[model samples]
Target: MLIRNPDISMSKANTVPFGIWPRLRRETCLDSGSSLGYASLVRNDCEKQRQIPVQLSKLSEKTTLLALVLGATLICGLPLLLLFKTGLTGNGGLDLGPLMEAVQSRSVRSALWHSVESSFLSALAATALGTLLALLIGLTDIRAKGLLVFLILLPMMIPPHVTAIAWIQALGPGSPVLRWLGLAPELGSTHPLYSREGLVLLLTLQHSPLVFLLVRAALRSFPRELSDAARVSGSGSLLMLRRITLPLLAPSLLAGFALAFVAALGNFGINALIGIPARYTTLPVLVWRRLASFGPDVLPNVAVISVILAVVALAAILLQGVLQRHLRTSLIGLPQDPLAIALGGKRPLVEATLWLFVAFVLLLPTASLLATSLVRTYGLPLSAETLTLENFTEVLWRQSVTLRAFANSTLVAGVAALVIAVISLFLAYFLAHRKPAHRTWASLALTQSEVAFAVPGLVMSIAFILAFIRPLPLLNISLYGTLWIILIAYVSVFLAVGLKPVAAAFLQMDGSLEDAARVAGAGFYRRMTRIFTPLAAPAAASGAILVFLTAYNEVTVSALLWSTGNETIGTTIFNYEDGGYTTLAAAMSVVVVAATILIMLTMNALARRVPAGTIPWKD
Candidate 1:
């Protein structure tokens, strides 16, 4: 329950700008603490004599939250209904025969099994690496920690296929790294990168940051007191970690693992580039090959697979929600304790090992991309002699599909990001005012968002085709192969990704200001625009950046949804990779990475503008 300080006055003297509110949470437990604090603040009127009942405030919040939930449900549910209606009307409504036969196919089963196996291995590996990296960077006193953190997260900016290409180039025969290691020609045609193991390695390196970021965030609230208590009980650091820290961090680990797993499962670019050539057929590759090879014959099977994958992903997300709920219930009541486990004799060695591990896992792939971008050689043994700006220059001058793809990606992704930001801000605002009604609504919204994450890119694209193709004939709108379809796909894919951060930010905010605004006769829009939006700038900006980056770097959905005329960075890179244009792909990847970094920097700046402690809206 939120504590309300009745003694405090809501007057001109106390009314500050939007930034001062969040700081107050750090100071006053009376007015800013607990769910009850919010209702009290809302009820605290100089003109009113009596206190507001807790049940009434909760009921009001619940009602408001339900309305928001209903709105989101309509937005998400209608499109899906339309999609299915179109799919059924065009063909035979629901055809199971083809799908069933496809599922029974040996090749289909192999592909499914391989996809699951690769995704699981890669996700687990990424989780381990990400957790260790987060601990090293966030918990330990590492040198150049900030720079190292940036380096570690750099691979995430590069698309999986691009990373695969860069690695293949670097580690392949006569590549710079291979030559440096004195294992040039003897490496033969056997590349470690063009196999299932290679795909797993690439995915793990590329996706580990998802784990690292979430884990790092979780680590922030970890009190050292638990460790102190454990030590006082005569437990060593290792034992204390085993008994205490791990348990506390379990929810975070689960959240990260779930996300990484979904990412791996849905990944298409990495599988296309690395897994396909080695005859290692994953579900995504199989889906793409089927559609490209067999057309709509594999439609139902694709749908079944897509739906199944989405269900699995939804289950993971649901599990995360359950785990997070458990964590909050179990851990939120615990007091903050910042006690540290002393490293004793092995601190330096442990630190060094962690640093080296991070460097190798995070730095190497990015460095390879950057290194290859500056070079003209596609074969290997890249040297200063082979280094040039030709690749970058070509991107500027070439009137190829790559350039169009870049433009398309930027235009579509930019719009989607902006739209997502606005929607998430409102959703988060509503979520902030919610009580127990929050979980169901948030869960539903999250489930819709998880849809795109579960299905392979090709399968989702196929869904788009089956869903949209017949609609145009009926409506005479001709939406198929248009940018709208692509945009829609992006929104469906990224909505959840954008929502998570914004929801997290909202949860941190004190709800009293919103209540006060309501009491002051402010309508919902006025309260949201006037009070909440300004304060939530930081989180909104972060969400927008994440959405923008994901959209910009997206390969899977774009590859499937994009028509010949409609190109995206992913499609461009995929084409280049397909044609064995390795250096060009590296150059394109470099461009994407640069763009992501610029956007992130912009987000950071936006976050700093309404600095906390300066504005009342910070509440």
Candidate 2:
């Protein structure tokens, strides 16, 4: 029988003695000899006190994480939705007429299909070529591997539009290729470059290096032991390659293909600079042209296309993410001895073929551009008299848009890089040190940042205009033509790029060190300043430089957004060419290329100074 009192309850029939929770239940109660229960009361009090605060802390952490995730999602996703939604709204309120017009338009259909075909073909070709190049450089002992690798990578450093400009100088409409074909003087009169094939070629050349870099890294990490074992088991090289290497490299190859596809699909710079002039139309150009010619009425259609492009990119990224996770989990952790296979008697032929390919793909266009820059005119007047520094002089003295453009580029890109780098470090730290209760939602918040990269630069710029223009009056700041808008756009566009490297660095770092500092009475910002920042400086620097270059060479976003006198080097170069300043644009390209190379070299040096294991993997 159990009895309840006003102050306490007691059970007399089946009472169990406690020792230590479960252990106590099976043990004897020494206090039974005494008519007292003081020990059990004290034990109960201790346990309850210990758990209450912990439970409360966990609840708070979870609340914080949920709030962060929701906030970040709205910040990153709302602009895109708003940019598109604005088209649905007018003075008459919500309207579906514009949406229907876009859906029913024949030109939009053609343009959409054209963009798809161009991007697919370009990405496929670049991936194939890039994969082959990676094999030659990474798997085999090719001569001049170091030098050739850099040269092959050079195309990636140059902006696609700048590369297009160089190609136009060398191959488009005129010059030696046409002269040899007996049609030099009448270049555009006979041969036109503004065609689908020309756009594909330009995109392929520009994007191939990205594929090469990804595939090369994948090749380096491949488990050659599997291949060797297959060989010893009487499997041929061809069989092993087809069964093993291709499948293993699939993730890397897919990632490269997806990135290239996304770039080609959304790229306005190349399409505008080369394709549009060739009288060819793609989705980006069509969107811009429609926007410019037809005003906001054409926006919903552009938004639809932008959303479609983003969805495709997102799908590809999701696939890549799944494959990467699988690969990590499936790692066998087997140790293998390094093995190098000789080319045997066919070494020279293999070497020659690789060199020939490198020369044609990497060196030829650049060489032609350099040659054109040196010559007085665009022909082969081999005499010393024909060669002059006049073009270079004119570029320097005219104090053309190039000078102002360079200053603007430096200011915008430099500031954007610094801001992004600092913000990323804190974000990474918060994410890495999140409590278990907060981990899930914090991760979700960070994931949305990746989606921004998939959006086309032009689409993002248009969204920026729609979102920012009206809010300026309410926000108490004029951002329309000021450097602030460009700065914000630049950071937003590249924040993911900066965050990924820094976050990876943070994750590799042991949390105990930060915990120790915290326990030792160090505050959040101080601990970060004293510990994590110094430790992650290398990755931070690398990410900042990468962001800067990305912003500096960005034409797609800057094109629609640039205000008068706020032009970047990229936009100005395009403007110069549009205004018939070919020689000056070429000279400016040289300057931008030189500056970019210098920055890259410096970053590589800084990266080398950091200790191994700091970067997670060799990037």
Candidate 3:
């Protein structure tokens, strides 16, 4: 009744029999060159089975894909294009005056320089640190690899502003955690993390997880033949690593660097909270100050500076993509596990050091945040008497803005997640199963999504402001300062995050299932609902969860878009700290961190349902 294929498990075969494939009287055979060689599904012997005509039952995939592309362009393209037009041109010709003045201004120049210097240095640090972690956890026999990876990725999930806040409390003069450790800096002395060095340190900590993810993905996807050949030629571990593996990892390293650089360059929370006190400024903070101080009157001038920031960010990402394309080497295998060499006696020491680093990076700061949250006041030392839960209670129950922010964040993020999930499901299907002529359209949509995500959230917000500050043409309704703008920006900016896993899941699927359903006279919607949805449901669910977690905690996307009653949790906490309500900020941040962890754990429970590597933290 069945043709056995060693490459594909019986469970997978069971998934493909959605229709009457088994009813065919023909013999089954396997194709060796099939994707992943899922031989059981490659039954070319069923040629007669596929000859059935179902023309009228076929769906309009082209029209659907075209509509998706147009929608993607509206979401991702028009805003930035409008922002550029507003900045680079006026009612007449080229508006070189404002652009030139922005560049020539002393403060603007200094901010630009600071941004470049800090991002470069931090990216360098992140690359090194993340590479080491990836190599250790990915390729070596480090103990508790699952634990290590989770810890490594944990910091990335925590927002940059929260990291800044935690570290400030961790290292500050009045820090309860530092005081408890007897390592507190003396009161009245300038806080150490309030300088350029401090900004770089915090940024490196914040963005290193991104590098870790990219580098580890590269390591996992690398071909093993290189390592095997080196070993057969009598190369030791270090020699092979230096000469073979590291050289092959150059593309990943450069990619990690670029991502880290762009993340740090566009960072707002650290630049604001730390840079302001130290008299240092960066582009994002400068944009915020100018816009916040002058409001819509200075929107055009701010647009000029935003254009410069956006250009730099885009250039770095584009350069990396070009270089990675040139440098990338295809693996002989579609997917395989990386080698896990034994560490011998050094395992204990490596494990200890790794855990120590995790403690400093994640645990220490989290502990500091908790301590800060428990305090009755900002500078008060923690004690049995001074300890209080009033801050949490106040934010969770008493404060109207806090309550409203919670509601708004939940509403917007949930709606965005749902919307993105549906769009990604269809887009992924088209991208993975399209005709040859339609490949470009699918890639075009993906590219636009990538371009939107590559730029800083700060810049995206400015673009949205320029694009939507005025009322809609026909509707005569303004989206500016509304929750809808934040939702739209979230959908546009985070489409990439939601699309990746769904696309990956689609790529792994056998197109033959859809073909069989069609041959059975099943319509497009029927095949999709009955066949593809069940298989990809787990991945789509995970993608939606990721989008929700990302958008829910974001401050930058809504930084400019949020208004009186439309505050998000991130903005609320930021405002609290900015307005000298540190205890409430810390309390709210703790709650956010807890909520993020809970959501992440929920996603982890879906790990088995999705493909490997879909859940980033899960091994």
Candidate 4:
């Protein structure tokens, strides 16, 4: 506020910043008859005070953001860089000898071939199934579409290893459902899922939901007018779809395929638990086996393989980006409500088939998992006489490893979530509302995270082993087999997950509130705490919860990183199944799946409060 009538003798010069005093001196004009420039002096002083806080606040924020970005870049980028360095030149300076030799090795070549074959086959299957479902659900007036979409996506939410365990129980000789229906295989016969075809099947099942999500989103933006015009011109539905709809959707379908392929290529759980018995070896499984069986003695060889796998995944992503750009179709108008094609006379049949497929996908594994968890032993039938709570009790209460793993995963995931949330809150702010003068470093950090995420978790695990196997430079502390390494890796790998919703929230906010606050002399912290934080908290929490869920159940990243005491929940369950403790694995998986469902349901309850796109399965 300014004083309208100050005495001519008054001076507020000393209150202003340096150089402003000389400027104020030139503005002041003393007069005995009036207050002269007194009003201007006070007004200028008030303006200067307001501007000083803003300048200092921005300086403080910029300095902090730089420090944070530097830390983020190191955490996210350093490991991958070291991984490439070791893989490329560990043998000698600027040498390609080791990488070439490793890639050419018989075992390495076989694994690489297997990886590509399985990924390609599974990706094709996933794309076909997912695209069909997307069209049926998104473009047609299907009953229970929301519930159906959510149910269809549940497999994606379940950890791949868990899915593997459930399917094994569902179709094996001892399968409760099969036995109850008198359809069980011979007791001595080998399990069905322990084969190459089975590997591809599980991979397809695990990844189809990803394709569904992407293709459905694309379908939602499809031009309804084109479909109406085609129909009006007497084009049949199938023909029109083949000629128009599919062509427009080609880019999204390609992206879906690439995503599924990369996901399958780096898949660890299925490749290990299923492929190993099937005599199928993918690169991810090969890397895990090499390191686990041989330890760090074979780290250099492992690094080379990891680099190859990373290159394949990144290459697929880059190719998708290029092809998508080339295939992009520009629409002239805003996207309308999604196409709602009437299924007409065949609606009942189509709906019944969809329900049947959903049942086969969801109920079989879920029921088998519950039956296994309730039984006393792995092969025991789930009759009332055979049922017991011992398996759940053993894993949840009696077993030290399982209990420790639960605690370890909880602590690491919770800490990682909180850390990522805080970083995302500000990092997204800078990115979403960037100033020209803001450092380019924030974007560099963001890029590192995106790259880290795109690279497989198995590959990132190798990077961590290479980066942290040695004691750190300043601290002289080794993080190689420690939970801190997992924490850091999680923060690096899942940062993009945490950044997305907050960034979306930031983009949606009205800047007028902040401008008004700034005029009222609000500092950066005040504006952030009072305005921005409240506005973005729901979204930040959603992102953090997403990060926690992802990192908590993920076995791929922690498979190679887990030591005895620091075993994560995913690794512990995986090890149990690998060690022939099927009942224990099923019990633990049941707990994890239940928790995941509950959390997702909770998020759905709050979805209306957060920005869209945060909850993938939500409408």
Candidate 5:
């Protein structure tokens, strides 16, 4: 209610809104340059006042981010740290004695040798077969190419243990097909699949699809001009393939081989099922057997073997990286049409051979599983008289353990998927839109997740055991023998799978919409909730589905983590098989396969809405 002085301006004399005084003063000071010092003082005070909210916002964001980073570090980083800690250090401090003893042990040496030899052999076979199929289907005018490719990829989607089981049932002494044809091996005879050769064969069949997918992708991007130029120079098909195609495809072939080799090296299911019986243990199987038999006492020794396995896997990854560096091809523009090779008279023969391969690889094994599931007993042939639905009924309804396992796996996988999806969205946002400093940290966190996934599941399980066997500090709680341990392991292992699609989606997204939102004074949360979430939802959903599919049937990580009362689908199937309940295991596997296919089909229906390349099975 005080009167203003006459010298004061009318604008300065009027009462201002609560937040408008700073702006009015700022404008007046700007208009009159003589008041610059006053302007500086006012501006600084206003900035300090403004910074409170901003600082609080930043503090909140940083707190949330810190929590996320610490969680990831606990899940992914701690296990690896524990592995090195156990392997390199002990109560005595910085000791190499355990590692040296493990390396020199006869069992360890034998397992390492078997792992290396079988992995190399299987990789070679898989690469050759996959490359051949890729060349034939991707380059030539093959009939039903899509269907053939899908069928070929099906084997890779099946769990390794399930593949082991199917092959065992298909070629074992009591094989239904072999018995039907009167070519079954004698009852007491050794099963044909219980050998190193059979192990390699099964591994080759399982991993060949990996090579096929890589080579086919490469072929799809192949320059049409090279083949066209070769043909114009009057080169024959074989010559052109040898010179132009193979040379260009060398990197993909090597990459495929490296991937297959790494996969075989870390394969626990095949090694456990087939190699154990064959007395040809691999490192993964050795680790499992040691831990299962001796408990935590053998953890230090097993950590050394895990390090060896990790070294081999890392070497393969490095080799693939080197190969990929040399794969660069100069392109004028988008890739032209693929070179189409007309088979003409040989088309029918080629198609028949492809179908035969499919029948052998996919149809036969699945048929064997179905037949085994329907049988009354393990060795009983599947006839109208012997066939029964009792195994299915037993596992699905009557057996409480199996029912519990089903429930456990579904609940765990679903929760993992949902949680990972939500976490991945925030991670991807940070990766795509954060400040450079924040992005660097985000990328480092992502690398940890990759390391978790890259390490074999068996090795990861060992790491988790070593890390969490004792009670956690401060909390005084032990996660060692709990279902929470398995859930934590799944999150660590599958984080990369969940992040990939979301990151890809973010990379392809337009930035202007976000910028416009920010310019309109929308906060980070608003922009994310209103713009980013909608755009990235499809990708996140796809990634979640992928995680579910992968975790639902996974056995390697849960093999050692499962306790007596808590069982997973993978563990249950394995236990059934281990306990000589083949029909029951087969019934469970059939249900799992059917569930996987149904989920994949549902995803296929939704694929159109999702970004391309999000679904592994889709084009």
Candidate 6:
């Protein structure tokens, strides 16, 4: 019943108390004492008030997105930039002279060639073995498939240094198993596993599970109808494998191969432990040796080597991207149950063979590790008389270095995990819910993290050294030789690990709960705490655990970063092995392996509460 106020002005009415109040007041003259002057003043105030929040919110969003980009750049981007600057420039101008010199050096060339050769051979071996296992377990009617897969993956979960230590003990001349079986090499003869061939074998064993996981996942989504149709068209088992299964698996195989290649190229433990003894230096080993021997005087040279390593890793990443794009298939609906081929009378033999392989790969080395840990000295044969807990007690109780390493690793790894988990949660939230423009920036920031993670740990460590070797600009304090530098490096290298599961969880989330909280007048923090955090906690925790596991016993990043007081478990063990304390190293490695298994088991216990794919060991 309100008359149109053509004279009173529409703008004044629309500004103050929204349209309803204006119309009501104008129609009824509800406030007899309120004049048009007062109304206009109130309207103006209200208009200003209303615009503030909208402006502030827009500002806030822009600020947050900007901060995320800057933070990611600081953490992940700056180091690589610094590395390149150090490697590619000298004096006051751009120069690739040092890099060229490094590339031309005989030692550098040999190390580069060795890295390429070992990585390629190891990746090929891993791909072949992994594909075979994946087909056997994923497509065939294999017994105890879950248990077998878990056991096979145990090697991958074990730290590379630990694996190297165990294998060293297992195959060395003094091996308890080898000696017991009368197959031990003579004490004066060289260990069989201290060569380039040995490096390839260990790299394959450590990384084969990666290929297996990728191929197994692909096998799970495979269209069973193709196999059925092949059989119906008179294809035998072997023919079906050749014509239908293997062809479809090519992309995954290639992807896995690339991943293994990258992993092997970056390997520090096997390269240092086995390669050094056999005079088979790889690029990572060269970087370590240079840094260890010459300190910062050889920084430019090592930076050049780091760049080469990073380039190789980046190439692998690009290849993986290309393969993924090309491999995209147009499949119908949800994937059906995996095809299970029967083995008939060959089932028993196949199962036996698989179990035997598991025993040889997992059980034997682990047993050797345990035996070596109990011995009084490196070459001492294990017996009732020779066996003692002295090695364990010495490392676990007597040695301050070992205790400090454990404490430092736990503290640093724990903090890194927590910090990364929190940062990743916010980042993932922005990525999942932000506007298109903001998301692009956020994605660009995420790529920085990817670069940090993808580059070899040794290279990343060098990057950090280059970036942080100097004192802070204003604070005038150096982080050059502290645990903080290692912590920062851990955060950079493992940020991607923490982000993956959280981001996956967010992408799959309904968003309705968050939307409802917003509609209910909940603030950003309120909604995040009450609605999003609880939902994403499991995935975040899983990521945190992974970060902790990767960082706790990590040698590669800390290898070059650790100072006298700040030793990591990995570096400590490596030091022990380097210093002829093999028995002590074995003891620590045993504890680490035990701790890793315990953590995985804890995650397994909580699998029901976590998201389906959160725990990798679970079904």
Ranked candidates, highest TM-score first: 4, 6, 3, 5, 2, 1
lDDT of 2 by residue, 269-357 (tens): 78888877777788788877766776654556566655545555667678767876665424354434223456677778988887787
Q: What is the TM-score of each candidate against the true structure?
A: 0.80, 0.81, 0.88, 0.89, 0.88, 0.89
Whole-model Cα lDDT per candidate?
A: 0.69, 0.71, 0.85, 0.85, 0.85, 0.86
Candidate 1 residue runs with Cα over 4 Å from true position: 1-75, 78-96, 185-187, 294-298, 315-329, 332-340, 374-377, 383-385, 434-446, 452-456, 471-475, 601-619
Q: What lDDT is obtained when candidate 6 is compared to the true structure?
A: 0.86
Give candidate 2 regions above 4 Å deviation: 1-75, 88-97, 176-189, 294-329, 334-339, 375-383, 434-437, 471-475, 604-619
lDDT for model 4 comes to 0.85
lDDT tens digits, residue span 1-619, model 5: 3332344456564444657655666475446455333455466666665566556656665665676678789899889988988888879889888888888999989999999999999999999999999999888988788778877887776788998999899888888877887888999999898998999999999899999988998888776877888899999899999988888888889989988998898888888999988999899998887877786568887888898888778887887888778885455545666777999899999999999989988777788889999999887888889989999999999999988898899988999999999989888887886478767777877888988887889999989998898999999999988888999899999999899889888988888887788555466677778899888987888788878888998898899899976799999999899889999999999998898887777767877877766576677
Query: Per-residue lDDT for 120 in model 4?
Result: 96
Error of 3 at 555 (Å): 0.6
lDDT: worst 10-residue window of model 5: 1-10
- Between prediction 1 and prediction 3, the one with superior lDDT is 3
Clashing residue pairs in all predictions, respectively, total 24, 3, 0, 0, 0, 0
Stretches off by above 4 angstroms in model 3 are: 1-59, 606-614
lDDT of 3 by residue, 76-109 (tens): 9999888888889987978788899889999999
TM-score of 6: 0.89
Per-residue C-alpha lDDT of model 1 across residues 1-619, encoded as one tens digit per residue: 2443444555424444446554454333334444433344444351232223344545565666666566455445544554344334336556555546656888877887887788889889999989987776665554566556666776786677777776777667747665666765565578767777888888898889889887776776776666667778999756876788778888888888888887888888888888877899877787677667656545654555555455555676677788778775255435453343455676788777867776666556566777777777766556778879899888757747767887888899889888887878877765554555566676676666555545455656766676666556556786678888898778766777677667777788887887787666566667667878888776776666667777888888877777888888888888877987777878887787777677655544554575542211111
Worst 10 residues of 4 by lDDT: 26-35
Q: What are the candidates' C-alpha RMSDs?
A: 10.6, 9.8, 9.8, 4.7, 4.4, 5.9
